[model samples]
Target: MRKLSCLLTGLMLTAVPGVCMAQMTADTRLGVGHSVTDADLRAYFSIPPSGKGLPAGSGTALQGETVFTESCAACHGEQLQGNMAPGIGADKLIGGRGSLATNNPVKTTESYWPYATTLFDYVKRAMPFNAPGSLTDDQVYSVVAYILAQGKIIKADETLDATTLPKVKMPNRDGFIADPRPELSLYR
Candidate 1:
């Protein structure tokens, strides 16, 4: 019994170091995660309403139509209308101009979204439903232009880049009032 007890104690102590060393040699640091690089952080694609984070790219609504037809139409529908049919659910992209004041409001791109830059940001970051963040910046701009044009928010011929997209006003630009919550108040 005494020998067995020491043997068990010896085995446990031996196993403890082996388990500790195992993680050290496995290329992971304390099981936290891989070290992040600037590229990884930059990949988030968080473009503000100011269009500041927009990457270098250029495209027109005409070009966007092609990209949208190929990548977006499946989920968004043939007319950029929402897919509420059976199991296919997606938001409508155009034509809901005056519904905000109505009881049954249909908030589409033209009716609800305030900033054109946000449209580009959303498409660039989370779009095509199936493959998020797959489209290039140029394709994002084009798609934004196409959707805006369809809603008559922007001219069909207008080219949407970082510079112009922020400037293109939407119907709902003034829909949002300044958030006047007390906590957000400036120190007086």
Candidate 2:
């Protein structure tokens, strides 16, 4: 028993150093020292504020009504009034024209969004919640047209394309001002 114990001890001590060195060598080889190019980090989807990323298509409010009825009405409500769950299920897309200063403000596209481009970008990125980026460019344009029509910002017959979308002035066009903090006034 004593001889066996000595043999086992001798074997363990001999094996330990080799194992430790092998582990260290492996770890060094797997160290975090890699480079990623711009292409690797590029965004798969993005929309600029100038409707720069809008695709080549056009649609009208008349077309959008069909798309909205088919794809969006279930979650966003029949009139885009918003559904309330444990949290707000969906955002109301209309009927907040002059309610920003009030306690119960309704911040819909008509009342809040300064740029039509922002609307196009947002709808293109994450909408229909369940099936994002699923709408064709024409469908997206139509939906925007429909929402704009509902908001009373545009006529139902107006066409919405990349060229015309950016020109649609929202009511709150001048609502936002560039941050002017840390100026001469602040120093005083």
Candidate 3:
């Protein structure tokens, strides 16, 4: 009787694993490999400086001003000077053209952004603070134009398109230098 009881217990334990495995196999229906569509993949990805993944929309500065006044002026200030509250602070987006070497430099769009593509890409990915990338292509273009104009880089009447945006020159275009660290040669 004792031997029979022990044999039954061992058989039950061994069968339990098999039963679980069989149930799992029956419940699941996944193939070896599957992927999302190209459009779905693009919805989540952002474009970067190398122009790796930009979208096809175009915008103009004239269109951007209306968008900026309606959406951005609250936090970024009416002139892009940045607003400061107790705990909430907005970034300054214009000026700081020649203050990079100063102790209290005011780094802004005029002095900081390396390329115009970067500005467009950044606005498209993140802007407006409360709601990011909510601007239309034309709105984006206009807001960029407004900021650039405030920075003294471009005129208010100037229209910005894909071709003209990249061509616009910033005052601090050559401000950034390539990294040369370690100081090994200097020490030697």
Best by lDDT: 1
Each model's lDDT comes to: 0.77, 0.76, 0.68
What's the number of clashes in each of the models? Answer: 0, 0, 2
TM-score winner between 2 and 3, please give it.
2
Query: Between 1 and 2, whose lDDT is larger?
Result: 1
Model 2 alpha-carbon drift over 4 Å, by segment: 1-45, 86-88, 181-188
- 1-188 per-residue lDDT for model 3 (tens digits): 33443344334533542232112222235555333344444445455445555555555556666787898878887777788865446888988877889897887888778777688778876887788878777777778887887777888788776667777777777888888797866842
Among all candidates shown, the one with the greatest TM-score: 1
TM-score against truth, every candidate? 0.76, 0.70, 0.68
Clashing pairs in 1: none
Candidate 2 — number of clashing residue pairs? 0
Model 1 lDDT tens row, 1-188: 33443344334534553232212233464565544343444454366788776778888989999999999988888799877867657888888788999998988888898888777777877887788889988888888888888988889999988789889989999998887888766632
For residue 107, give model 3's deviation from the true position in Å.
1.0
Q: How far off is residue 152 in model 3, in Å?
A: 1.9
Question: How much does candidate 3 score in TM-score?
Answer: 0.68
**Model 3: lDDT of residue 83:** 82
